[model samples]
Target: MSAGDLSGRRALVTGAASGIGRACAVRLVEEGAAVVAVDQDADGLAELAKTVDVEQSVVDLSQLNDVDRLDLAVDIVVNNAGLQHVAPIQEFPPDRFSYILRVMLEAPFRIVRGALGHMYAGGWGRVVNISSVHGMVASPYKAAYVAAKHGLEGLSKVIALEGADHGVTSNCVNPAYVRTPLVENQIASQAKAHGITEDEVIERIMLERAALKRLIEPDEVASFVAYLCSDAASSITGSSMRMDGGWTAH
Candidate 1:
């Protein structure tokens, strides 16, 4: 999509305080979309709002009730909020598992359901859910995160089908390890869980899983999502675009 196409469009991005969500929000504004940024970090959200024409809101996506207010009327909704709590199934806390599912899967569903209502009313909208390569295939010690991401992919598909008639397209981007603060934290957690160094976690656990053997840049993922949000992607709903560096191809 071109800058002119997004000039008057309004975009709401969850988890917009940092990492992929922040990058996506910044890119959308650059593309000329009016942005509403949502995150749990009030300070971070404040920092982001200063630079852009952003309406900032503090939200804990894990609570389903948060969606009541998240459904701000907008032309685009990017469900980029998620968590990575790494632990073996046997050792994982039940509360942590539920927490991951709530934020990564359930919240996205609520956001999409609410957004679709507005989208249907307007007759044009884009729903972009940011998933992960773990949604396609998994490794050791990321059960909850993997399950939630996998579930999110399924939810996006259903939304795509149901929203089709209303001219609302739903799609997901399943990216490989991106060098964002979220993934940095995940690497640290993995290193701690598996008794490996952080460097080893990135080189062995993350890169080894990717054919590219490198971390994906946030902009790479953001660009694809921006495209999906465009009129050019009108026929691209109900699809999972893999930015996984051929990890699933193997």
Candidate 2:
């Protein structure tokens, strides 16, 4: 879509402070959408606000009560907030699993639930969920992350089905592994869990499933997100678009 395609549109992007979330926020704004950039990182949001005119919302997604309080009446919602804690299932902490689910799955539900009325009333909306390859498949020592993403995949489809008559679309963008702080931050945890060095975690673990060895850039994923919101993609609802560098081909 061009600059005016999303003119007068308003978008809410969670985890908008950095990484893929930041890229999506910037991309959407470039297309003339008024964006509400939400994240727990105040400094990072300040940095983003320096270059783009997006409303900043500094709130933790893990807090359900706070998530419900967010002004979610918007035309677009990008559910991208996430965290990773690598550990075997037997060793995984219960609280961590709940926390990840809260941010990745439950928070999206709340956001969409709150926004659907406005979208339905306006007869137009887009919900682009930033899911991972793990949403479709499995990986060791990532039970919570995998489960939450899988749940998101299901929720996206449900939203697409229910919102179809109202001119609303919901889809998931599933990337194999993007070069973002979330992936970088997980390296140490992955290394410790797999009993390997950080370098090995990238070389032997992260890239092993994909045919491409290089990590995907944030802009690349963000580009696909923007495409989904374009007029051209109005028919592409309920689909899990995999930008995984052929990772799932195996």
Query: Cα RMSD (Å) per model?
Result: 1.7, 1.6
**Candidate 2: regions farther than 4 A off:** 1-4, 188-200
Q: Residue 177 deviation, candidate 2, in Å?
A: 1.0
Task: Give the lowest summed-lDDT range of ten residues in model 1.
Answer: 1-10
Candidate 1 lands at a TM-score of 0.94
Each candidate's lDDT (Cα)? Answer: 0.86, 0.94
Candidate 2 lDDT, tens digit per residue, 1-250?
Answer: 4434798899999999999999999999999899999999999999999999999999999999999999988999999999888788999999999999999999999999999999999999999999999999998889999999999999999999999999999999999888899888877777987899988998788899898888899999888899999878889999999988889998
For 1-250, candidate 1 gives per-residue lDDT tens digits of 4434698788999999988998899889989999989999999898888877688879998877866776478889999998777677999999999998988888887877777777899899999999988888877788998899889989989988999999999998999889899889888877998999998998887888677878999888888888998888899999989998888886
Q: What is the lDDT of residue 114 in candidate 2?
A: 99
**Best lDDT among the predictions, by candidate number:** 2
Question: After best superposition, candidate 2 residue 220: deviation in angstroms?
Answer: 0.5
